[model samples]
Target: MDRRRLLTTAVLGGAAGLVGATALGSLSPEDVWAAEGANAKINPGDPDPNFVEGRVTAVSDAVVFVTSSDGTYHSIRVTTGTSIWKLNPSTLDEVKVGDGLYARGVRMPDNTLAADSLWVNIVNLNAHVDSIGRGHLNLDHHGQRVVAHVEQGRSAAVYNNTPAVSDMSMLQAGKHVKVIGAWHPDTNEITISTVYAAV
Candidate 1:
């Protein structure tokens, strides 16, 4: 077998006996996302060619089948080393048909992706802050109002390229911000994991 397939087989063997947190490891979703992108030669903001965005159409053993939003079909191979995020670090069992996915991984010679990281129902949105309420922010995203809830202890804010902090006190009304969070499918609501705004 080729090196990639060989490595995948080994991981599948090792992962079959593990589940939950022990199988997924402690890496944050963004850590895996950014780390994989950083190692590639793509420019910042340029879509990583190794990335795939789609909806899960099927799942079998360690493989997930997806149909991209644009209609391309993909086979994603998940191994123990893959970091999965479904709201938080997750297991493959949490993935379901119809769930949206964003995956980054190495492409095998057969055109399958050997997934390094998989994020289910994740959204990165740009919006204008309309108002702030008790533990939440009302946002206007492309003219649609959205309710973003602050997940205390997990929610954080990043300002002007500085380190992220849990304090969201600097957010102001009518300012533009980028939101990275888990989307509540079919609804204009999300739970904020990180908010990027000016200090």
Candidate 2:
């Protein structure tokens, strides 16, 4: 198999085994986001009581396109003042093409949404692989220590002598890794997405 297929098999297999049989099916970025939206907690006081949850369809330097659960789409403008998970764009991995997102913001007069905060709590993390082992890896990211689970289906690629796993590998223990998966607030564990090693 090619590198992408191998990595997909490995990550999916690892997630299934680790997360349990209930989570065995493959999760598209949209699928993961949709599930999170169903359970998302919405804070009251917004003008629009009918506010909806959505996933980011696209992101650019200044705007984000959100597709809501009801099949409605909106283009939300992202200002520098917007509250994202990570302050630095380089460290921000919460919102990608396919990610679960909860956006709470104001609706503009033009019918577009102006998001104050875009929560991608359900998205996967991206990180670089600093070290690898038989069934686990240690990732260094954002001044934090993260542990990742490796399984039989997991694959690896070598970039400049550093092993890159799936997006989760971005959490290399001593290197600059970006995490883009879900963050377990209680345990602080992040389910990984993509890991990009600094060039």
Candidate 3:
């Protein structure tokens, strides 16, 4: 057990930067939508009438009915170019009733939302960095290990609450972090979208 402990410690030590740094933010709106299997128009930081938050109530061939948190109802149309994300990249067929959602698109004359992108059950987590590995990192969330895989050129890091950047080197092991990622199909693994930390 002594040798095993020593080896494990060494491995973790090398993996853990044990330095002082941080990271923050998420994928661009267009990139996020594209990951859902479409390249539809999803303008980033635009002040247009193109957003909705609600719970799915019904789904038809290419249309979805939803009830907003305020009790208002909306008809959202999903086109071929419309992107849908549920946990991981997903298809329209996977969208089900009762799933919370956020959609961005244009409004048709009939008042139905022509969705360009839809993200279902997205999660934002606060955790502490446990260890770092090549192209991945281990995070601790309430005592559970959340293995976050780094997507090449996609993971954004923000240190000390500064502007977001694509440099993962800013992330130091053993620091508290905010992770924006998608939960893997049915596992503790997560595909990291962005990470925010304080140095």
Candidate 4:
């Protein structure tokens, strides 16, 4: 079995086992994200109302400060329940200064977002697999060049509505793919999160 899959499944199963973990007067970080997300009044398909997307300018314990592209400032608070995803499901330690983040949660009266989820360096793009290398993919996204990295155990492929598979051998040259990934800041490069193919 894939190690990444095991890690994710274990975390999710642990979260399940922790049910009423809160009732015991304590909850895990996984529980926090589940609980907070369940409580928020969110509009489906619309960008999260209180979502904040920015680069980390500072990190002080559980609080991370960010500056958006438009120069607006936002403070996002990470909790035990908040889910943090880097190239894969990760922990807060993977988050660092200068990392880009997309946070979804409740905006407190004090202006800090109590984040339920944080997707660090995440991006979604529609591109053509222009070429392939031993461990990389050259992509053309609307005429823009992008280099997509292949992280073993982390990268997967989805073909024709089927489940994603670890083998990327089916990804042929000149094919179009909808890719979700972690975009390297200020660069055309991205570490693929998932690569979905139409045919």
TM-score for each candidate, following the candidate numbering: 0.76, 0.37, 0.51, 0.75
lDDT scores in order: 0.80, 0.48, 0.69, 0.73
Highest-scoring model, lDDT: 1
Tens digit per residue, CA lDDT, model 1, 87-126: 7778999999888898876777688887767888887789
Per-residue alpha-carbon lDDT of model 3 for 1-199, expressed as tens digits? 2322322332234422232111111224425544542533647655345567778899997789989887988888765445676655578888888777888766766777776568776657789999999999999999999998888876677788788788898788889998877666347887777788888
Model 4 TM-score, 2 decimals: 0.75
Give Cα distance to truth, residue 71, candidate 2, Å: 0.6
Tell me how many residue pairs clash in candidate 1.
Answer: 0
To one decimal, what is the Cα RMSD in angstroms of model 4 from the true structure? 8.8
Model 1 deviation from native, Cα RMSD in Å: 4.4
Clashing pairs in 3: 23-158, 23-196, 23-197, 24-157, 24-158, 24-195, 24-196
The predicted structure with the larger lDDT, 1 or 2, is 1
Worst 10 residues of 3 by lDDT: 18-27
